[model samples]
Target chain A: MTRLVVLSAGLGVPSSTTLLADRLAAAVVRRLGGEAEGRVEVERVELRRLAHPLADRLTTGFAGEELAAALEAVHGADALVAVTPVYAASYSGLFKTFVDVLDRDALEGTPVVVAATGGTPRHSMVLDHALRPLFAHLRAVVAPTGVFAATDDFGDAGLDDRVERAAGELVALLSGTATTRTRPTEDERLADPTPFEELLRRAGAGPTG
Target chain B: MQLGIFSVGDVTTDPTTGRTPTEHERIRAQVAIALKAEEIGLDVVALGQHHNPPFVASAPTTTLAWIGAQTRRILLSTATTLITTTDPVRIAEDYATLQHLTGGRVDLMMGRGNTGPVYPWFGKDIREGINLAVENYALLHRLWREDVVDWQGRFRTPLQGFTATPRPLDGVAPFVWHGSIRSPEIAEQAAYYGDGFFHNHIFWPPEHAAQMVRLYRERFEHYGHGRADQAYVGLGGQFFMRKDSQAAVREFRPYFDNAPVYGHGPSLEDFTSQTPLTVGSPQQVLERTLGFREHVGDYQRQLFLVDHAGLPLKTVLEQLDLLGEILPDLRAGFAEGRPAHVPDAPTHAALVAARADQEVPA
Candidate 1:
């Protein structure tokens, strides 16, 4: 079974970003099957709830219980659906702060579906221009099709088509059938007990008179 | 177990009084705190090294050497000597001189300074912090153990046929403790050299300290040092005490609310419950400190952060008196039912005597 985690960086109770996240999560479940009978298990984390704790973590350099639980959910998920509200032509500050708190190598090879909600269609390119590159920097395998929901797109059939396509891509990735090639697992990529002899050799080959 | 105090030597304004000590006053207060530790029968006094504003303990060896001249029994150690930027040869020479002057009352804790600007100021790149720690300490280790050393390593000029004067006190290097907050590589390094591991047990929860100590102990045994239980471990704690717990809280709350490092974050109650900071009576401090062995197992040293967060020198000295009141109970409680195979914290005289034993016949 695949565990899917949805991270919504929406600041309000009924935020459009969170609405998009719920739709994406439901689409993932529907692609698997019905809700109770689906092979995909879903968990949702609202970064809005973690704003104060994230700020505290920034100051103290350690996570509180709530932030730690959110981080654990992200780290342990088989695939992640991240939805954020667009602000200043980029992801919201809260979304970026949450991402900043994660371990550098935490998302090394995980599959991710990036989505965003904005007031205008002009900000639609944020999915590729900002969110895609951010996840790419983290080494996450972002889906080729990113979903952007404008104020009017929420009730339109085109939004449904985009969600379905992105969710299908995610399911394919989870089932090991996606065209998106997988990166090496962390254990396979990292050299355990990093060869000390190589380190010594590097030390010996230093600048000298 | 060795019990004492460690100071970061921060020069913050006392929130209760809105007054900050002059740098000279703060430095002299640290010396007075060390002297009071000895007078109160504490075992060790460690000072931290910081090279920035709001902190004054940039020269720990010089401060410790001055304290050594005034005191007789208290162990003078650094909360951490920066191993990443400081030249290893200077470390070898200066610490040997300190060991000789103190008659072996000196041991050092090595740590990578966290301040980024300090790294470049000392001609080091913070990116190579772990590599610098690994290579610098490797050379520092050889300099003390071998008199005529031929060494070459990254991060420093090569040395050939050079001796780090003084040759250590009685041909025995000062005991070393590797201090770390989160780095597993440091734990491995400490274990590989059979040195002590110290967790700055103040800012974080017990589970974090337990996890780090467990890794160190497991690796210590894996490196053929000894059984996991025999690995030397030290922990740092912070406390505020009065005759009454309520008075203690009322007196320390202002400092807790406005002090640096942890203030303005978790509430005082929440922070105390989560970390090792105990602000209460002598009995309460003793109970919480004794509970440490429950998570990390039997350990050798316990150091407290008694003189930080802008508490006045008189208030800190009073806190030391409270510690002296409970010192006997703490030692006895920690000693109760401790396994016989576990080793005590290494001391100058004890280490020298152990070396002497190794050289003599059965």
Candidate 2:
């Protein structure tokens, strides 16, 4: 029942990044093949047209009808791929704001592949210094093969290759076939187990009266 | 500690020199500032979003995405990405894609934005600005974390079973800093979700910034994210540096007088004295910046306004050189001096390490 989730944070109706996400999902589907024992569903969440802001106020809890399903999908997904347009040398505010809404561990141990589309090839570094740290904070296992395509880099064939390669890479990571450097070194990921269970117990306790 | 240089990208005439830089020149200067930030070993370089006369960064994402391609070690961030007016769905998809391209070196600061007229231009109500921000961010949050969203509410159409494309890199969404100048409500919102609180402390005095940060920290702990000290914090600042403090003031005078955002407001000297603006030498700049920790506590990110008021590209590049030479040492020194109780960058390794440590028996 492993599910692949594609989260698109792009502008423009016909986006290069969305296409990339689709191609990624397809590659995962292809890799999973019949080996997928349960329903291997592919889901996409377009952010631009959403109704409410991701950050909550005093009245709102992490619950709203619009967000309930999305939260469920995230909690349920076995793998995730997030794509955004680099803004101000980082992921878009829209993208980050969305992340702000989730529990800190929403992506804990999940595999992710970051992708971006821009006007030039100069901004590829945002993947490592800006976006990676945020996800790293959430404890997501990122895919080493992140994809960046500039306006100039995209034509018919090159664009296809970029999308296919990113999709293929995510599939490899999800299927445990690809070596994902986006993750912490095994020892690092294996941080002390005591603190984690305390965290769980504390979380279970909730806000005590 | 996240250190960055932010650019306003203003094209203006230097009143003393009687020369005006073209918009293209201004944009180039902003780029140079970013490169200088990297050369100086700063952690990040952020660009502000402004679509009006005198400002050149109409497409902040385009510019930052370009910067992402060039830098290696510096994290990229946005001073403000409009959540109220800009479509959250587009923001989600675009940034998710960017995350993949950049190898995960990204995050952003969200704002309701300053320009009021911008609301109606996007066919929105300015009066409902706060509501727009609240609703839009809520949906945007869901989109990044979830895959199949059946969303229905105001602002956008209902979705039966909609899926946003190009999921977030590794299923984790980007980190966010909610930037606010006067709104405690925004601070409260950031706290409620355990997100970072960015008090763009440029215009405000220390007391106000301290109060805002305090509120955010208290609420963050209340929400069970972590302790008050662990709450993420980023502050905004303005700086103009030269070897000589007096010379720096003399050179920056014309730009300060005529600059759009601060032009004809408080005297630049008075503004710097009262606010976070530090107009002085590199050593003075470092000393003044490190002082921010006094009020804000162990902060997460610090961004400086370096390119604005129509400063020439060459002059800005020189400033960057000075910043680059001084800032790396300052960052290391600052980190070394930080209290052990302060939280560091919330990295995956750190999170896993902390989790593992928590799991181990005493």
Candidate 3:
């Protein structure tokens, strides 16, 4: 089963950022086996709810239950739809905070559809300026098309085209038809471990016989 | 199980009273706490090694030597000795000397120091942390066993036919525990050498610690140390207790809220529930402690962290008193299901006797 994680950094109950995320996720599911087919499972993470845990993690170096679960969901995701309301000309602080909580290589090679909702179309640059660079550093394969919905653009028909394009791009990458990335088989240095003798040899110390 | 107390030697402010202890007072307080541990019949007093301020245990050997002079039985150990930065030659000499001074009442834990600046300050590189731990410990292990060592490693200057002075007491090196907050290689290192692995069972969730222990145990058996369960394992935990659980919660709350490390983060209630932090009566502390066996299996050593985060010297002593009240019950609880073959935590006497039985240095 392909797990789709939608991370929305909207603070309001009826938030446009989450609405954009929902549209993108639904469009991707439609492109795949569809929601009724059950091949694609969607898990929505409201970054607003993770506020307290993120701050606590920053201070304590621990993830409480909710934050750990959200991180686990993201880690398991075959694809991601991240939607954040632009704040201070960038993705919401809550969105970045959640990103900060992730392990350095958590999203490596994962396909992502980046979207944002903003009060002004001028802040639309945030998708390229903020979210794109951030996910690039995390080594995610972001969809070629990124959706940016301004409050005014939300009513326009052009918005649907961008959301569908972004979803189609993500689905293509998720299905491995348009492959630009590989997860670089996990370095099993810790998982399976390098034998102690090899480590000693690498460190210029031979193993004791 | 060998029950003990380990201090990070944190000089923190008393949150409620707005009083920060002078480094001198905090340093002296550490001695008092260690002495109290012995006086109250606890088995060990382990001190942390930190090269930075806010932590004053840089010269732990000197402090442990002093504590050893005043005490008769309590073991002197390091919550961790900085194996990454400090020269292995120095560790070999100093700890062996400590073994002599303490009348063989010593065992030390090897740890890569957490502070990043410490590596550069000590003329080492931070990026070589695992390499340093691996190579340095390999050298220290030989320095203790081999009469004269010709050694070369990536992190340190080569030694040709060099002998570390004051070779380990009675020709039996002190047992070493490798400690790491979240490093897998350290667990593997501990297993490779058949050393004890200590998981600081605080700050993070218990499940994470369980995985680390599981990995160490599996590797220990693979390395031919013993059965996985027989591999030496030590756990670290923290608590604040009183006769009544409510009073314990009320008193520790203010300190838990504003003290360093975990302060101002998770609520006292949430922290206690998630981590192995028991903030309640002695019985509650005992109950939570026994639950550790369920996670890590039958174990060897258990170290509790106390006397940090600016809980006053008086309160720390009181916590020790409460710990003492439950020591019998705690030991009995640990002993009940533990098999007879599971070795007790290694000590100098035990090591010396074991060496005598083998008639060969290991």
Q: Which of the numbered candidates is closest to the native, going by highest TM-score?
A: 3
- Mind giving the per-residue lDDT tens digits that candidate 2 earns over A95-114? 88778776566678788888
Per-model DockQ against the true two-chain complex: 0.33, 0.01, 0.50
User: For candidate 3, lDDT tens digit of each residue in B92-113?
Assistant: 9999999888889999988888
Clashing pairs in 1: none
Ranking by lDDT: 3, 1, 2
**Which of the predicted structures, 1 or 3, would earn the higher TM-score when compared with the native?**
3
Q: In order, what lDDT does every prediction score?
A: 0.88, 0.73, 0.89
Query: Candidate 1: where is the Cα deviation over 4 Å?
Result: A177-209
Better of 2 and 3 by lDDT: 3
RMSD of each: 3.1, 26.0, 2.9
TM-score of 2: 0.61
What tens digits encode model 1's per-residue C-alpha lDDT throughout A1-209?
Answer: 67789999988788999999999999988888755875767889999889988887876778889898898778777889999999999999999999999878777778899999999999999999999999999998899989999999977999999999999998887776442334433322321333434444444555322
Estimate the TM-score of every prediction.
0.94, 0.61, 0.96
True contacts kept of each: 0.21, 0.00, 0.58
Chain B TM-score list for all models:
0.98, 0.92, 0.98
Per-residue lDDT of B1-362 in model 2, one digit per residue for the tens? 77777766667787667898887877766776787777777778877777677778778878877877888777777778888778888889877777778877778778887677878888877666556666777778889889989886566667778778898876777777788876666776687777889988776667668878887887788779989999999888888888999999998888887776666655676567767788888888888888888898888887777766667778877877888778766787679677787776664234446657888999
Docking class of 2: incorrect
Task: List the per-model TM-score of the A chain.
Answer: 0.85, 0.74, 0.89
